[model samples]
Target: MTITPQWKDELRARITLSSVIMRTDKLTKAGREWKGCCPFHDEKTPSFYVNDQKQFYHCFGCGAHGDVISWMTEQRGLSFIDAIKELAAEAGMEVPAPDPVAAKRAEKRAELIDVTTEAQDWFVEQLRGSAGREALAYLNRRGLKPETLREFGFGYSPESKQALPTALPRFEDHMLVEAGMRIRTDDGTTYDRFRGRVMLPIQDARGRVIAFGGRILENRDGVAKYLNSPDTPLFDKGRTLYNLHRASPASRQTGRVVVVEGYMDVVALAQAGIKDAVAPLGTALTEMQLEMLWRMVEVPVLCFDGDAAGQRAAMRAISRALPMLAPMRSLSIVRLPSGMDPDDLINDRGVGAMEKLLAEPKSLLDTLWEFERDAMPLESPEAKAGLKKRLMEHVDTIGDPDIQSLYRRDLLDRFSAFAYPPRQQAKRGPWRGPAAAPKTLSNGARSTLQKSMSGGQRSDLLGAVIAGLVRHPGEISRHSEALIELARHDQSAAPAIESLIELAETLDSRIQTAISAEQGFPAPPVDNRYAFLREGTPPGEAREELAEAVSLLAHKPALEAAMAATIARFDEDPEGSFAEQARLRQQLMTVDERLKAFGRKKAGSDTARDENSVSSDS
Candidate 1:
């Protein structure tokens, strides 16, 4: 039966390797993996290990390594088709019926791989021969050791257009063309695709040479400095990373992977003993490559040049990664010094600098904020608003709801600090005057003041508004100045209110919302006085209500203090104090009327809006 790559991948994903291995060998749990005696070789101690997370198994005794299907084929002595059939049966999947076209395509793919492998060998021979002296010298000048060259399968493609085809005559012209080693013009003439360049083989996760990337030895007008093979049956530059096969094992050991911009950077880092470094094959990091990176490590550090292009590349990777982000799976970013790539950094500052940079790579959130924050000038309010919009837009791309909420809160908090920084307090001199005497109150005034200070209705109203602010934490920044002033004056409710404001400043918006929900502030009073405190209120409306609440809360205390002052003046200036007291009473009445009107308007409108929403849904 002909099986497409998609079907094969689905089969592999469905079958747990440990379950299959455990049929014959007893496997013990080992951290995130399982271990057993070597299945390929007779060993007294357990050396075979299986990682279900990565879906692969390796035996330390005889260097045996493969996935579920491979285990069946190699250990059970089944052919590829029989092994896949068995696994598919066990996985409860139907094997695709044989298709002549798909079988031909599969065969063609194998042929293409063979052609590319042959071309790779030819390129390697050319690199060691007399014709490749300049290329060898170039590699030597770049400080590549001989062992590194051989290990990476570094080779050279001669400048002559026919060098590759001529050297590998065993591969038909069409086969070489399909392999991406030869370019066939529309007129039917064919020439070498990669010529006069230092060749680096781009491999699959299984270490098969799927494609080649070539860097020109000499500068030439209108020529790209580096060229990579066009997409072919065996190669997809976007889906492949330069050194993943070698880096995967290294990543397993270090629990980290460093992604660079190009193959040369990967080579440089590997030479410096950082073996877990990989790079995109002449393209930006794609979603597929990010998935591959995540499979190796929870968070892969993206190391890019510190220049503008590198920053732009990092942002591109971040954009691709955002939608794919999970709870612990994300990216860290390291920016090299300006005008330096990994190789240059390693050469100039030594490996320690690169290692240190990797060790302290910035979190994806930090890199994202820094990038968007400095993407353009924020000298104007409009620019700052633009930054906030861009940040929220990026955060919106995250598919995970929890991660999205956290990112939104984080970015918005950073934006709040940037756009509305806390006001610096003015320095004060020591007090030098005697304190003012307390004022005596009439029975009516004392009764009114005592009721207002009772901390029942008034405190509940204040708490509801504070809870509303917590629910709509983004509104806190707009009222930050007012909150600080309230914190200074309202000593009775200051601590609780101040704590909420501080939390709003730092905590994720979702967390603040969760806290408000848990606080169970009583539902809007029977009169619906605090309409904004209703669940699901719009942010704009909630902010307006919060502003009114703050004003009322602050005004009551200010009015009380003014009344005391007026009563104090009664002993000295009775006529003036009487007029001032009457004006203060009228002002307090106006505030009361405004509050009542606000509550009435919100209650009516909120009810209407809810009805409309229900009607629309219906």
Candidate 2:
């Protein structure tokens, strides 16, 4: 049955902030709030705070904050109705039937999916009979096991004109068209979508065959070698990865995911004992795909060809992974030997060789280092300076210092080491020099560079002003002029800072959200700099430190100029008094801490100790 908007809202309300806290024991009752480890992300400190009175929960670690419905949707991977039903069941209630119109639409969707499945089955059966022998032999030649064919739902489409239409009538044809299995011509003629090719079903996380990829069985001299399902309601080439459904669980268990270029590469890797592997479907890896990988594994090992294009793809993946960075999550790029893809490597050098290659995957820094080493003469000072500048630009992109340090160490090791002349040195060509020295990027320098690179003094001005306001709410009154000035300089950060000021002004108000809802995408350096502008500043402290920060803001002229710009930016919005909001936030945080401490004490000394052992930085 189809769920209505009202039903979704009702479901969301039932899973109220209090209900979620009740499910887990770590939550402790403070004066008015519940505090515990966030279920959405791995966090040691109790940053997932729930305001039962407000029916809201927020995770300071991941910035995942919402009502109970959002928690169910994100943490449990449930749709709105599904979340509602689950919560209702927990509360000993039953969900009412969906609206009739919604029910009809849902039924239609289900029918379409069923028809698509039937079409897939028919195609596979046809492959097993006449058209599939050539495809099966092709797979066998590639060392793919018979079981692999069944597991991946391999199939073949005949070159015959009526192979598909002969099996299913117009209903199936429409279904196939809707599922991206076939294309319709202007003349209304229907034909098999993938003729003379080996088919690979592309399934989503739920294992529904939404699309298909076909490798050409008989090659024409100038024709494209492969074809894929077009974008449709059920299939998104950008979002769907081949074999993700089968690979995700294995990837979670292993804590490492292997990403390849094609479906066969994924199959080959699986057959070779590397079960945690997925491939992009007829497209380069995308940010959405990377987010999926982040959910599945702590670290993803991307193996690509060593050719120029492959190296370029690796760089692209590196760029896209920046936003997903958090504690324990990492991206590693392994450049395979030239001219050999994963399948070739597995068939020739075997899984052991692949393991050895993976054992030494390149860090982003190393990839850049090699890229620089090949592009310019290291002996030239200008080249060194330019390379260092470019490298530091990327290094600064890393918000976490610990991760940045590891990259630095790896760079130093590569640059500083002088390879010894092995007994076999005589057989090799060319002599490379001793390794390069490690370069350190100062935290201050990084901040300065980030500010300068992303925008200009405007970003720094905004960051400094916001940092001051968050630490000292009283400073908002004392240095209102400065805040307005800062806000005026950076238009992008103006709204966010204005929201912070407004939140500070109203005790009854929550932090007004100005940042985009999609938080994990790559934001500009200034955007990241401004993330906590409204919430709070880093290195959080007690009332005394906040007061100190305020005092500093009261005197800092630069801060005053920045604050003035900030105020000007929000001139269009209704005036939001800051004192009341700041006071409310202070009270809430205090209450939250009290409740969290109480919960921790109740949980036991060991759990509290463990919480203290880990860093609170998300």
Candidate 3:
């Protein structure tokens, strides 16, 4: 039977690995997984774990690991076909009948693997022979030790067209071409595909050679510097990372992976004693390559050259990753020294410099913000606004809602800080309450007392919101951003809101007992119609009205500012800008009407109770 990857994936999906393992070994719950003693090794302590979501079981004791099918075959000692038959029967799935084309394709892939292995052996033999003097000198110039070259399987391809064809006579020319070792042009001409270059074998995860990357020894005009094998039944350049066969196990040991630009960079890092490094072939890092990297580490560190092209490459990777971002899954970026690749930096400075960079990398968010923030001259407001649009466009692509919201808020907050840098203020001691404050007053009340007692002005709407917040100090954190923005714009109320935030945990919820006992908190302003200040108002109704009051008092101005920014883009995107402008206008009117509904209510009997404190104190 020919089992396609799609079929295997379906079979794995239908069977929960934990349940199958549980049938043999006693497993107990371990968060979202099951844990028990490993079946492969005897132990008192449990080191095996199974996760149904990922459909796999792994053991930390003896390194026993596999999917459902692997568990059936390896642990039970069943043949591959028998394991599949058993799993299929248990999963209520039908085994696919043999496919002639698929069987032939599989056969061709196996043959191609052999051909590439033979070709690699031939190339290495040439590298150690008289034909490879120039290539050996080039490797020496690059300061590669013999051990490093042997470890990376570095080889040499001769300048002759029939080099691989003559060396691998057992394999037919058609099989050689199919394996990407030689080219057969339409004119019935056949020749070696790689020539006059230092070759690196690109292997699959199982250490089977599947492709080749060649770096030219001689710099000839109109000739490319690096060339990789084309995609064949056995190899897909976009889906393969050079050195992944070695890097995967190394990454598991180190719990990290360093992604470089090319196979040469991967070899350079490995020679520098960094074993857990891999690189994409000549193309930009694709999503499939990213998925493979993510399988090894939660956040792979992309170490790229520090030049413009490297930065662009990093951005492309980041852009591709944004939409696929899940919790704890992202990328960190390391930009090498300007005018230096890994080889250049290790040669010029030392491996220490390269290691330090890989040790600490910029976060995906920080990298994104920095890249777009400095992408172009922001000499104009419109230019600065364009930066924001680019950021949001990326944010919108993210698939996870919680992650998307966080990225959006964080980027916008960062953009706000960048576009409007905080004004410098002279250093001063920490804030203390007024000297004349009553000794028994709560610390928060005493602190807020300074602002009101300083004779600084507070608008009616602001006063009502503050009174609402005082009554419901538990809600202080819910609207922290709006409150902070209010403090930033209105210096008079800054102290009150700032104190309220600090006291959110400590302050008592009862309004009259907390602050009104000392006559320290404000009374709702005259003609104020905020529902929260009314007596006999239900707690839910009061909180809802108070939210609206704060949203109007603080967030409305921000809404207006955003709307104004949107209008600035009217020329660039008339349709989107116009639609956004209209939506914002609607929100503005909605907030205004909600506030107006409160104002329209007469100053109720509750105002008299508010008057009780201020009247006696005055």
Candidate 4:
């Protein structure tokens, strides 16, 4: 018999998600993580674990685990369709069958809504009880308020082995197992999920409880210091960022999101009246988290702990966040005082102090620029030359000329002492010509080159082709053979061509995947022209100088001699000026490469000519 939609809704409403979790009693908290039994499998010890920051659940023991939906499916023997319907119905809505696609989407959304409401209720109930009172006391000591608590959905998990189970009795043992609340033995018995712990509910962007972080009151060596939900359909640890829902609005208002390292940090921010703050539960900041933060505000503040590891982590975040940057979006690295977290800073120095720091937060480029100035000896010519080269490489990557100019000025100011010649001593010994030396440009050639290459797209179509071929060698073998064959003939295209050829040879799936794009291949910004042109440019040698001049002319003809004079000069002085002759030859090579690339297109048109010739012969 087909179950009516109303019946499913009524049945789901009756199922308490918290009760299901409490039925197993596997979860217990330490400082932050939640430890529990693998509900999907029978195990002696609790191995299923959840980290709110990571937003995922994994069972180190039996390995029977997934996100919330996966857990529900595994434990309840429900198909993905039925499970979504069941969860949606619990949220108190009639399942709308708008269309197959819409129906499926609504079911998924409804399940999340249902699960979120149930978890929120459980958390709120916990905060109202005795154990919740203890948690409240802890928050009070940290200077938090009740209204603040309510706004952030502060909830308490009562300190009872059976309280949650009693509240959610209709929930089946298998459902409880799926929710990361409890585990079952071979005999199929169940108990409380998080015993004797104050719970911190983890919510998604829509403020739904996809997971929980339970804090254990007592110090137990063997027990994990904290407990988290297992990977459920609703959450993935790598993807879940704590306090993002609340922080998003605040970030929108303030134009920044302060990213901390824990749930407590979020509370501290909220308590300090700085609601636009968030943290990852337990894992390192991820690319996905960066993307999420980018969507919310123009700048995301990375507030790392003041220790060495935290600084290292901040650097990593900077590195990851930089590539995702758009024109307006930026990331700032906020280094708290040593031995202090955002929570500690708020508690000791006040939120205003943190805000002040946030206001003047350091940019990654600024930090690296400072580091370069301090680390390098600019006074020496060799040091200055090396510094200029490295700095140019960095400046070349920055698409924004304004930001690049700012960095350039900062670099000059920092290395001013090193960039000039030593002041001559006065004729008399006592006083020198001047205390400071006059500053000079470190390396003019490199600077000029950087300026020249900065004007156009850096994207490499050939590189894109190579990347695609690596990912799908068969695809390259099918369509790009002509292009590859042409590249093989020309020295300039050889590097890009060989890369694709290598991929074709290896036939690696990963390379193929990386190359796959829905639209045309992605070109690096026009500013990246330097990367391609730099290698081809000639150096000090006769042949190298010749090649460099040719490239310069191809890219910027104003720099080269007229075509007729250059050819005549080369012919007459082939014996006299080896360098000039070589340069001319190099120019010819560049022209040849461009023609070949051009010819590939022209060859297609030539096909019509060949066909006409065949018709005439017939």
Whichever of 2 and 4 has more TM-score, that candidate is 2
Candidate 2: residue 465 lDDT (0-100): 45
User: Who wins the lDDT comparison?
Assistant: 3
Q: What is the lDDT of residue 197 in candidate 4?
A: 69
Runs of candidate 4 exceeding 4 Å displacement:
1-109, 112-116, 131-133, 158-163, 183-193, 218-225, 369-618
Error of 4 at 44 (Å): 68
Give the better candidate number (1 or 2) by lDDT. Answer: 1
Residue-level lDDT tens digits of model 2 in 1-618 = 444446545655655667665664378776788888876545688887888667688778645456665555444444455666778786566677778887786676676667667767977896788657777888788777888778888887777756666766656667767766667889997666777888777787768777778888767998668888888777778888888777866753564788988877888888888898898876777988886776555467899987888888887787677645643456788988999898888778889999898878887666777875576666666666666566666666766654565455545545544122235434533212113432333444334433533445443434444543443443444344434543564456555445555534432122222222132111222222222332453423323333333323222333334335544543232112121121223233333444354345436744654676674642
lDDT of 4 by residue, 1-618 (tens): 233545443544455443445454557774566777665445677787765544356767533334443344434434445565666665655554567776686576565545446756877876687547777776676676878777767666665656655666666556556666665668877666677666777887656677788777666988876777777656788898998777765664565688887887788778778888888877788888876676555467888888878877776676566445533357888888999988788778887899899889898777656555655566667887787677666555555543455456556645565576469865543221124452222244223222222332132333333332333334444333344434434455544444444434433322322222221222222211222122333222322322232232233231134333644663344222222322333344344455445345346546765887899999
Better of 1 and 3 by lDDT: 3
Q: Using Cα atoms with residue i matched to residue i, what is each candidate's TM-score against the true structure?
A: 0.59, 0.54, 0.61, 0.47
TM-score comparison, 1 vs 3, better candidate: 3
Q: Give the TM-score of candidate 1.
A: 0.59
Tell me the lDDT of model 2 at 459. 39
Evaluate model 1: give its lDDT.
Answer: 0.75
lDDT of each: 0.75, 0.61, 0.77, 0.57
lDDT by residue (tens digit), candidate 1, 1-618: 546667777988998889988997799999999998875445699988999989999877555566786666445534466676788889899988768887788888888888788888888998999979999999999999999999999999888998876687787888888888888889999998898999988888668888999999989999999999999988888788888879876775676889999889999999999999999977889988887676556689999998999999999999999999864468999999999999999999999999999999999999999989888999999999899999999998999775686688668879998899989989644322214432322344323322332343347566666656655555666566556656566776665555545545444333323232222222122223454666666666766777778767666566667767887875465334544554454345445656667667767867987898999999
Q: Predicted candidate 3: what Cα RMSD to the true structure?
A: 16.9
